[model samples]
Target chain A: MDIDLILKAINITVIGYIIVFVVLFLLYLSFYYLAKLLESQAKERCRRAGKNKCAEHDKFSVDSDTTAAIAMALYLHFGETHDIDSTKLTMKRESKRYTPWNSKIYNVIHRL
Target chain B: MEGLYRFLEYTGFANFTFGHGIMIIVGLVFIFLAIKKDYEPLLLVPIGFGIILGNIPFIQNAGLNLGVYENGSVLRYLYFGVLSGVYPPLIFLGIGAMTDFSTLISNPKLMLLGAAAQLGIFATFLGSIFLGFNLNEAGAIGIIGGADGPTAIFLASKLANGSNGNLNLIGPIAIAAYSYMALVPVIQPPIMRLLTTKKERVIRMKPPRSVSKVEKIIFPVAGLLLTGFISPASLPLLGMLFFGNLLKESMVTERLAETARKPMIDIVTILLGLTVGASTQADIFLTKQSVLIFILGALSFMVATAGGILFAKFMNLFLSNENKINPLIGSAGVSAVPDSARVSQLEGLKYDKNNHLLMHAMAPNVAGVIGSAIAAGILMSFLL
Candidate 1:
C-alpha cells in the first residue's frame, strides 16, 4: 500500500514498455535490412549465373549431340538427386476421413 | 466416545467443506473443457485431476501427507519446482528446442508487433494498482497479458508471494494466465475481425526468404546477448530459451534437443500442471484479489491483441502496398504460440481458403515469447 512503490511501478511500466519497443524495433531494422541484403545477394547470384551461361554459349557453342548429352546428364542428376520443379512443401492430411484422430481410432479397432 | 469422535473428525468426509465441493465442480468443468471441447488437454487434464486430488480433505499434518501444503509430501516436492521457479526455465528450454526461429529471423519487423503487444502487461499493471494490489502483486497479475502461462507462473512465484507463505497470489495469477492462454482461439478472432477489413485479411504476404543455417545459429546467441545486456533478470528464462534454440539449430546436438522438447517438456508439464492445480486450495484461491486478477487478465489479453494490431496498422501507414501486413497476424503477437498463430490462419482461411497465414503468423508468435520474458525481466528489475 506504499504510494512510493506504486509510483515506482508506474515508472517501471513506462520505462519498460519504451525499452522493449526500442529493442524490438532495432531487431526489426536489423532483420529487415538483413533480409533485403540476402534477397539482393540471391538476385546477384542469379544474374551472374545467367551471364555465365551466355558467356559459355558465346565462347564454345556445343553441337546438337553434345547439348543432348549435357541435357541428359542434367536430367539424370536432377531425377536422382533433386526435387525438380521446386514445389512448395505442404503439411496437411489428404485422407478420406474428415477427422483424423477419430478416424484413426476406428482404423485401429478394425485392424485389431 | 471421544476417541471415536476424533477419528470421525479426521476422516475426509468430516474435513470436507462446501468450498472444496465448488472447487471439485470447477475442476470437472476444466476436465470437460479439455475432453469435450478439446481445449488445451495437455495442460488441463493433469491440472483438473490434481485439483480433484488436492481437494480430497484430510487432517492437517496427517500421516498420509497428501496435502500440497504438507512438508515432506510428494506433491509438495513437485510444487516446489513451481515455487522455486525451476520448472518454467526448463519449460522454456523445451520450447526453444521445438521452436523454429527462422520465421522470426526472416521477418524481424513482426518482432516489433510482439513488443507492441506487451503494452497490455503495463496497462494491466496500472489497473491492478488502482484495484488495490501491491506493486509486486500488480506486476505478477500484469504478466498474464503476455499470454504465456509459464512466464506468468515464474514471475508470479517470485513476485506475488514472499519466500514464506504470506499473501499468495500465485494460484489466481497462474490460473488466470493459463485459462486466458487456452481461450486464445475464442478470445482473439472477434477482436481481429473487428480491427481488420476482409480485404486486409485476404492480403497475401511475400514468401519469407529462406534463412541461412549460419543466421539461424547466430540468432539465438546474438538475441541472448542483446536481451541479456538490457535485462539481466530475464537471463534465467532467456538463457535456457536461447540455449535450447542453439541445441536445435546447431544440428550436432540433435539428441539433447529432441529430448528437451519432447520427453523433458512433457514430464515438466505434468509436474508443473499438477502442482499448480494442487496449490489452489479454495480458501487461498477464492479471494477478492483473485477475482480482480481474472478480470484484469482478460482485459490484458484484449489490450495486448489490440496493441499489436494497432501497431501493425500504424506500421502499414509507412509501408508500401506489397510490404503491408495482414492485421490478423497481429493477434499472434501474444505469446500463446502456435494456437494464436493457428487462430490467425483460421481467420485468414475463413476469408480466403487458399490464404495460409500460419508461417507468417509464427514470426510474431515466437517473438511474443521473447517479448514477454523481457517484460518479466523488466518487472523483476523494478519490483524484486
Candidate 2:
C-alpha cells in the first residue's frame, strides 16, 4: 500500500496504453497505404485491358454467376483482376472455328 | 505367496507412490483424449505414451534415471530438443509448403490487419515485464499473442535460458497457444459479434482479381527481404518459411515440396509433441506460475483479436463506403493461419450469406505469420 509504488504502477500503465495507441496508429497508416496502392493497381490493370478508361466507369462488368465463380478463383490465384477483353476474345475465337459438334464441318467452315 | 510378492516388488507396484499413480491416470486420460476425441492425435498419442513410460516407478532401468541426488534427470535431455528452438521451425517449413499464399497475395491490404493483430504481443510483453519477469521472459510470454505454437516455443526456449535454465515453460506456452487456436470457432464469434454490428459483419468485400504467377513468386521473396531487414532475428523462421513457399511456387522441387508438406512435418510434430509433453512432469507443471501462464496466454489472444478489430473500425472513418473493410477479418491477424481466417469468414457469412471475406481475410491471416515472426525476432535481438 505504499503511495509511491502505487503512483509508479499508474505511470507504467499509462505509458503502456500510450505505446499501444502509437503502434495501432502506425498499423493504420500502413494498411491505408497498402489499400491505396492496391486500388490504383486495379484501376491501371483495368485501363490496360481497355475496359474503363478511368476510375469512374463500369467497363469491366461480367454476368453475375460467371463473375462470382471466376472472381473467387481468380482472386485466390492471382490477387488482381483478369483482363476481361483478352479472356473473352480467346473464348470467342476458340468456340467459333473449333466447336466440338461441328468437327466434320471444319473444312467447309474454314473455306467459308 | 513369496513368488507373487517377489513379482509385485520387481514391477515396483509394492513401492508405488501417490505421484506415480497420478501420473499414470493423467497419461491414461491423455491416451483417451488422443484415441477417442482425436485431440491432436499425432503428438498427443506419443506424448501420452511417453509420459506413462517415464512415470513408471524404477523404470530407472529404461532411461528413467531421475537423479534423485542431482538437479537434473534423463527426461531433461529428451526435453532439450524442444528447448533448443529446433523442431518448431522445421514444423513451420512444412506448414509453409502446405499453405497456399495465393489468398494473401490476392489481397495484400489484409497484411495490415495481420500486423495490427500483433498489438496483443506488445501489450502482453509490457504486462509481463510489469509482473516482474525480466526482458527475456517477458518476450517469451508475449509471443502467445501471436497464437502460433512453434513461434511461442522458439521464443520461450530462447528467453527461458541462462539463470532460469528451466526450459519447461515452452511446453505450457505451446500447448496453450495450439489449444486456443483450435478453439477459434468458439472464442472468436462472440467477440466479433459484440464489437461489430450485424450490418458491419455482413459487409461484402469486392472480389480481388487474378494475380500473376510472377507476382506470386516475387511476393514471399520481397516479404522476407523487407521483414528480415527490419528484424533479422526473424530470419530463421521467416527465411525458412518463405524458402519453403518459394520451392512450392517455383514448381521445380515437386519432390521436396511434397516431402516438406506431409511426412517431414508429421514426423517433426510427433517428436515435438512427445518431447514437449514429457517435460510436463508433475513436479514442474503443477504450480501457481504455470496456471498464471495459461491464463495470461488466453488473455493475450483475446487482446490481439480485439486490437485488430478496433484498428479496422478506426480505418472505416476514412474509407469510402465501398472500400471500408469488414472488421471481422481483423481477428484473423493472429497467425493461426486459415483457422483465424475461417473464423472471420464464418462470422461474416452469419450476417450476409452472399458476403465472402475468406480470401480477403487470408491476406492478413498469412501476413500475421510474418508479423509475429518479426516481433519474435525483434524480441530475440533486444532480449537475448
Candidate 3:
C-alpha cells in the first residue's frame, strides 16, 4: 500500500481523461464552425452567380453503384477500351488419341 | 548404438514439456474458432499458426538459432518492426486510406461518445495500480481497453518492452485487445441492451447531410494540425493516418491510396500477427501477470461499452425528439470498427425492421479510432 504511488496514479488518470476530452471537444468545435463557414461560402457563391438552385445541387448525391454505372455508360459511349491484352500469343501442339467410340478398329470389330 | 542415442536426444519428444502441450492446444482452438466461427479469420489464422510454430519444443541452450528470441533467427528479425513500434503506424495508414470519414464529418457531436468510451483506459490504469503493478506496467496494460490492437501494442512496446526494468507485456496486451475486438458482437450487444430501453433502441436518427468533396479533402489536413499540435508525440501515428487519407481524398493519388489500403496493409498485418503470436513463448507468457492482463482487458471492454451507452443516454436529454440518438450505436464507440457498428444495426433490426443504424453507428466508431490514438499519446507523455 504505497500512498505516493496511488496518488501519482490517480493524478495521471484524472489529468489524462481531462486532456483527452478537451482535445476532442476542441476538435468538435472546429468542425462545427468549419461546416457553418463552408455552408455560408457556398450560399454566397450561389447568390453572386444569380442561381437559386445551388442548395439543390449540394443536396444531390450519387451512391457508389450509380456512379460506377454512369462511368461504365460513359466509357461504352466513348468507345474506349478498359482492358489491354498482349498481342503476342504462344501455342502448343496436341496429339490426338483414340477413344472406344471414335476408333476405326473398334467400329470394324463391331461390324464383324 | 551411441549415434542412435544422440539422434534420439535431438528429437521433439525428448525436448517436449507440459507447457508446450498446453500452448499447442490453445493454438489449435484459435484456428478452429477462425475456421468454424468466422471470428477474425484473417488475423486469427496467421496468429494461430505462429503459436504452433513457436511452441514446437526445441533443445535448450543449443546454438541452433531457430526460435524467435534467438539472435539471427528470421522470425526475430521480422519481429523488430513490432519491438521498434513501426508496424502500428503503417497499419494506421492503411486504415485511414480505406475509411470514409463522411459519416463522422457530417455528424461531429457523436465524437463525444468516442471520447466518453475512453473512460475504460483510465479506469483500468487505476485498477492496475491497485493490483500492485508499477506505473509503467499499469500504463501499458491500461490501453487494452481501447479495443484497438495496434494502439495497444504501440503503447506496450514503448512503456513495457522489458527495458528499464519494466515488464515486457506487448504479447498479452495485443492478444487481449484483438480477442476482445473480435468478440465485439458477443460482448457489446448485451451491454447495449442492458443500458438502453427498448424504445430508445428503436429510435431513428436523421440522415447525415452529404459531405462535399472539398470538406473531405480539408478534413485530414485540419485534423492533423489540430491533433498534432495538442499531442506531438502522436505525430508518427496521426501523421501517417492523415497522409493516407489525403492520398485518397486528393483524387490524383488513387494508385498510391489503392496500394496503401490493399497490398501494403495486408503484408504488414501478416508480419505483425505472426510475430506477436510467436512472441508468446510458454516460459514468458504463461504467468500470473498475463492472466491479470486478460481479466483487466475484459473489464476494460465492459466499462468502455457502458460508458459509451450511458453517455449517449445523457446526451438525449439535451436534444429534440427528431434529433435523438439511438443509444445502441453508442457501443460502437469502443473502436472495433464495423463490427460494433454491425452489432448496433443488428440490435436495431431486432426491435424494428427497416431501422438501419449502421451509418449512424459508424460516426462514433471512426471517432473512437482517433480518440484512442490521442489517449495513447496522453499516456505516453505522462508515463514514458
Candidate 4:
C-alpha cells in the first residue's frame, strides 16, 4: 500500500539476495580448489607408487574411458549391492585380467 | 429412537466441529510424515500425536489436571516448555556435542559464506516488518530464514516472551523453518543449476590439507570469543556449539561427545517436537496469518540460496584458477546440516563425478548455523 515502504522492502530483499549469492560463490570456490588439490595428490600418490617403468606406462594408458567403466561397475555393483564380499568376488570373476595395480586403483575409486 | 438419541448425546458425536476435524487430519499428516516419510520422526511423531490429542473435542476434562483453571490445559503445560525456550537450547547442547568443527577449521574461509547466507534472515526480518508485523513478531518470523529449528525457537521464545508471556508465533515459525529445511534437496538444486553452467559445476576442487590439532582446538574457542564480542546475545548458542566442537577435537572425552551427540539430542528432539506440535491447536493454527507465515518462510529460503549463488559469481572477478567454484554449494550455507551439503554434492556430481562437494560444503553449512544464531541473537537484543 505504501510505495516508499514497498521500495524499501524490495531494496532490502535485493541486498539479502546478493549476500546469499556471495556466500555460495565462496563455497563453490573453496570446494573447487579443494577437489583440485585432492586430484593432484591422488595423481602424485599414483606416480610415486608406480615408480617402475611397466607400471608407469600402464597408469598413463589406463585412460579416462577405462576409469569411467570401472567407476560405473564399482558403483552399480559394489556400492548399490552393499555386499562388499560378494562385489569383490564378482569383480575378481569378471575382471580376471585385473592386476594388483588394477586392484589398487579399484580401492582408490571405492574410497571416493 | 429416544435411546439412539441419548446414546449419540452421551458419546458427544454430535459435538464434533469443522476445526476439530481439520486438526485431526493435520495431526494425521504430521504422523504420516514422521513415520512413513521419516521426516524428523523423533519430534514429528510425538508432536503429531500431541496435536491429535489436543484437538479432540470434549476430552479437555479427562482427569488430566488437578483442577480446571483459566490458563491451564495439558497441551498448555507441554506448550509452556517450548514457550519458555527451555527445550530448544538444551537441544542445542546436544547438537553442539554431535557437530564436528574440524570441517570448519580445515576450511575457515567458508565461514564468510555462512555469514553471507544469513542475508535471508535479515531480508525476511525487514520483509515481515513491512508486512505489518511489529519488531518482535518480525524477528520471530524472520528466523525461519535461518532454517535452524532450535535457534528459531530460542529467538522466538526470547523475543515473543521474555520471562513468562504468551506469544503464539513460535509454532508456525518452527514448523515452517523445519519443513523448508527438510525440503532442501527439493528446493536448492534448480536454483543452483539455473545460476551456473555445466562448466562451472564440473570445476574440480583441490582437497583440503590436513588441519593441525592445535588449529582445531583453537578454532572453536577463537570463534566463540570473536562472535561473542561482535554479538554478545549469540554467546549461549556459539558457546555451546564451540564447546561441543572442542570436546570432539580434544578427543579426551569420547563418552561426553557420544552423550552430546546421541541420546541427549534424541530426547530433546522428542520433547521439542511434541511441545511445538501441541502448541499448534486449531484455534491458533487456523488463521490467514499462519498461511502467510509459510509463504514468507519459503521466500526466505529462496532468497538465501540466490544470495549465495550471486555472491559466488561476484567473487569470480578477483581470482584466476583452473578450478573455479561451483556456486551450488553456497545454498548449503543455510543451517540445514548435511542436507543442503548433500544437495550441493548431488548437483556437483551431476556435472562431474569427481566433484565431491559434501565435506567442502560442510564448512559453510556448519558456519551457517553459527551465523543464523548470531543474527537471531542480534534481533533478540534489539527487539526484546
Q: iRMS of each prediction in angstroms?
A: 10.7, 6.2, 3.4, 8.0
Candidate 2: residue B113 Cα off by (Å): 1.3
Tens digits of per-residue lDDT for model 2, B185-292: 777778887888877787776666555566667766776776666667888898889888887888889889899989999888877776666655555555665676
Considering DockQ, which of the candidate structures 2 and 4 is the better prediction for this target?
A: 4
Among all windows of ten consecutive residues in candidate 3 chain B, which has the lowest summed lDDT?
Answer: B59-68
Residues B251-358, model 4: lDDT tens digits: 898898888878887877777777676666676777786788888899889888876777666665565674355577778888888788888888888777766777
How well does candidate 4 score on lDDT at residue A7?
61
**Measured with DockQ on alpha carbons, how good is candidate 1?**
0.21
Per-residue lDDT of candidate 1, residues B289-324 (tens digit): 888889999999999999988888888899899888
How well does each candidate superpose onto the true structure, as a TM-score?
A: 0.85, 0.74, 0.89, 0.75
Off by over 4 Å in 3: A58-112
Q: In model 3, what lDDT does residue B1 have?
A: 100
Q: Relative to the unseen true structure, what is the Cα RMSD of model 3?
A: 7.2
TM-score of chain B of each: 0.97, 0.88, 0.98, 0.90
For residues B1-384, write the lDDT of model 3, one tens digit per residue.
999998888887998889888888878888998899998887888788888888888885587777788888888998899999999999999988998988888889998888889988999999999998999999999998888888999999999999999989988898888888888889888888888998998898887888889989988999899889998877878888889999999999999999999999999999999998888888878889999999999999999999889999999999999889999988888898878888988999899876778888999998888888888998999988
The per-residue C-alpha lDDT of model 2 at residue B226 equals 67
What TM value does chain B of candidate 4 have? 0.90
Best prediction by DockQ = 3
**Model 2 CA deviation exceeding 4 Å by range:** A1-112, B1-78, B161-167
B341 Cα displacement, candidate 3 (Å): 1.1
Q: Write candidate 3's Cα lDDT for A56-83 as tens digits.
A: 7576765434543675699797886547
